[model samples]
Target: MPLALYLLAVAVFAMGTSEFMLAGLLPDIAAALDVSLGTAGLLTSAFAAGMVVGAPLMAALSRRWPARTCLLGFVLLFAGAHVVGALTASFAVLLITRITAALANAGFLAVALTVAATLVPTDRKGRAVAVLLSGTTVAMIAGVPAGAALGVLLGWRAPFWAIALLCLPAAVGVTKVVPNPAGDGPGQGRRPSLRSEFAQLTNPGLVLTMLVGALVNGASFATITYVAPVVISTAGMGELWVPIVLLLFGFGSFIGVAVAGRLSDRHPEAVIGVGGPLLLLGWVAMASVATEPAALVLSVFVQGALSFGVGSTLIARVLYQAAGAPTMGGSYATAALNIGAAGGPAIAAASLGAHAGALGPVWASSLLTAVAMVIALPSLRVIAPGAGEATR
Candidate 1:
């Protein structure tokens, strides 16, 4: 609700765009760099690896720094990395840039989550997080598509420049709007030591909650990583229809996140329990209808809504369970989410490599969602009692 939160969302938009736009640019990059498509794809994996490693490492190292300072520094660093990436001719240099940018992005997100919680009351934390994550949905709807268009029309390097430029305004806004005093959490500026903060990892509830987050997100990326190809080959759609289907999914995700923000605070159980099973059903339906244009299109929207709704709710649950660690709590969520981002697509790729049909990713998504539900629904009692009720 605060201006700071919106500014944080804007910053996240640039980061999300950089992260997701590559799926559409890999071919151009591969050709330009004189490498195989598989090697160019490693750029994406590098970013995820940086996110997973940098989340906790950067969060812990920057714990003593002012929150606003950390955010500003990371934003500038990310923008600078993009500039270097755009100028580079060597694939190795571009790879380093992706890693550097992802580290900055990860650190920024970790601090931003903690800062968002401190900006609002305990009851509104879920909504605050939703507002922050909506940036990603918007990126899916507009940024990735636009980046692809730019790459096609202006060259693959154009989107990199655009991403760098996009961050400038967000960097300026972060300097102006985000309060400098909110370093990590409230109090006399007392900072917890690494030993004490890392101790939160020992909590079974928090660990399970993180695992739930990873599994749910893995399910999401599993399908989404392959959605474009599925839409083209399976649904018999033209290139124009690819972005249309993706736009529908993104719009559905926006609506889903809005609902999650409203309900997750008090009724996390309902949000996850109902949404998780429905998401699994959506994936099953998606696989069955993959060859049907109308049915597949409709299923994508429903799948997006259900997948993000449950995934966002699980993030709120992880943050709550890791509340004792404040800044590190965001790192926990970030690592879990990125772990899924990396692993899910790898699984889907393997399935496709095994000569599974165009629908392989959909079935992979279903299995992952089922695994997530099996892990999550039964342990809701231990991992996520309603916020309004007592925690076990």
Candidate 2:
């Protein structure tokens, strides 16, 4: 991978840390801001909403700008938002900062996906993307915990300041490394018009590709959203084991993504076809053995590996299918993943509200993954017989 890809991943790490770290600081934020915990949780919802809406909106608005310029602006904007968030005393101001930060994060991710793909050869696009996305998995493993510790030591607002500081190096790196899309690169030449970009939305292959991505991601999140409950209540584990279980899941995900990156370019459809069924089975296993502590822990790791392995493959497929519309392709990919991230927890919460036990999230994951497979398997046969490379 290029140094530019690593620099992009550095930026992603800072943003991902800010995105997930808030979960640990919500209680502190609520107390400090004189708001209810439920109200403070709205900050998270606002960020998710911003990502879903901002991915495409920001991408389109910045479509004509140079890739380097867009990335630099987004990174600096993200840092500035965090700085403001750290200094704000009003809950409303802090909430707005989260939304602004999320918008910047979404735009950065969208453009980064396109830039990463273009930075590599057609065959290595999946690996390039995997390298880029590895930042998030790393964040889950390291950054979130560090942020939580920072919050505990220096107070909740401290992590926000740290995140803003982290972005400074990322901004400097982006400005120095990222190439202009219009320069002598794979993304060079005539840009697609807005009309042509919209036309790709009607591509059946691209639509199915994104749908599969969303459903798979939704299934992953449904289980992950309630992982603590499943580990504690369902499996009767001690509270101390929660972090251990989560760490296992994160480590597994990192391994899965790395492995999938190597295979995705060569066996994209075959990997997804096999991994999807296994992922559904993994969820079912979790639901069935919810009370078995050993089985439950193992299941979490296996499911994480399978979920990200398949999920990353599907996203690579989306990029390939929507390759003609470079600007909109990443937007569609970012929006689909964020949609899943938002919807999965809502469905899981509903399942719990209906008197389902701790296993409800596992069941929800199973159903969603099964649906993804049903849609994806047949579609792959029709659209991806030899579809490793971009189609148009």
Candidate 3:
């Protein structure tokens, strides 16, 4: 890999850290801001909601500028947002900062995937995008653990500060290494209205692929927020060991992503079909581990691996479905992933509040997998893989 590739990866790592670290620090933030944990969670909601709004908006406006500058600007916005998040005295001001940072966060990642595809040879595009996106896995498996530790040991403000620290180096790295052409990227000018971009999105196959992405992501995140609690409570583990088990889960998650990326390029639907069920089984197993600590750890491992691994296939599938209009498909996938992250938790929260146990998320996860399985069936009846370049 080129050294410059690492630069893009750095930006992703920083962005992923910014997105995931907040969950760990929510209580501290809530306490400091004189708000409830539920209220502090609005920070995550605000970020997701902002992505739904900001992704296409940024994609549209930034097309007139060079891709490098746009990415750098978004990083700067991300950094400044975190700075305000760390320093602001008032909850309202902090909320505003999060929204701003988060909007930039979504826009940055949306373009980053497209940019990554351009950075390398066409043959390596699959893995290249995977490597860049792998930062999310790293941030979740590694950054979150450290950030959460920092937040708990130092204070809630400490994690965002740590994020900003990481961001400074990453911002400089991306600026130094990522190429800045004098004009827009290849084929950029032809991009029509966001409506035109989305018009292609209505294709039955593409919509189904996106639904697979959304439902899987939503179920994963929704249940994930409570995984540690489930492990400790249901598995009857010592409280001190929660982080260790969570670390194991994270390790499985990132490794899954790396493997799935390579696999998706070969057999997209096969990858998802296998991955989705593994994840469903993982969830079911996780729910049933009320008496077996050993079983809980095993479930977490499988959960991390399969849930995120399937994502590579899911994303690649959407891009393929969009045919010639990849940018729109990419942006749509970004939005769908965000929606899933939000939707799954919302469902889990509402249901878990009722009489259900961990089974609530487990069954919900299973239902989603079933839906994705049905919807993600073969779309190319006449033309399959390696049938020559797709003409749509």
Question: How do all the candidates rank in terms of lDDT, highest first?
Answer: 1, 2, 3
Residue 344 CA error for candidate 3 (Å)? 1.1
The best candidate in terms of lDDT:
1
lDDT of 2 by residue, 1-392 (tens): 89999999999999988987888899999999999999999999999999999998988898877888889999999999999999999999999999999999999999999888888887777798789888888888888889989999999989999999999999999988888866421245577787898799898998888888989989988888788888888888998888788778888888889999998888787788888899999999889887999988888889889988888888877788778888777888888888888888888878876566777888998989989888988888644546434433
Off by over 4 Å in 2: 183-187, 387-392
Cα lDDT of candidate 3 equals: 0.72
Each candidate: what lDDT? Answer: 0.88, 0.86, 0.72
What is the C-alpha lDDT profile of model 3 across 233-346, one tens digit per residue?
666678877777767767887888788778665555466766777777777677767458888777777877888888665765666666555455556667777878778878
> Per-residue lDDT for 328 in model 1?
84
The better-scoring model by TM-score among 2 and 3 is 2
Off by over 4 Å in 1: 182-188, 390-392
lDDT of 1 by residue, 348-377 (tens): 887786566777888898999899889888
Q: CA lDDT of 186 in candidate 1? A: 22
Which ranges in model 3 have alpha carbons more than 4 Å from their true place? Answer: 181-195, 378-392
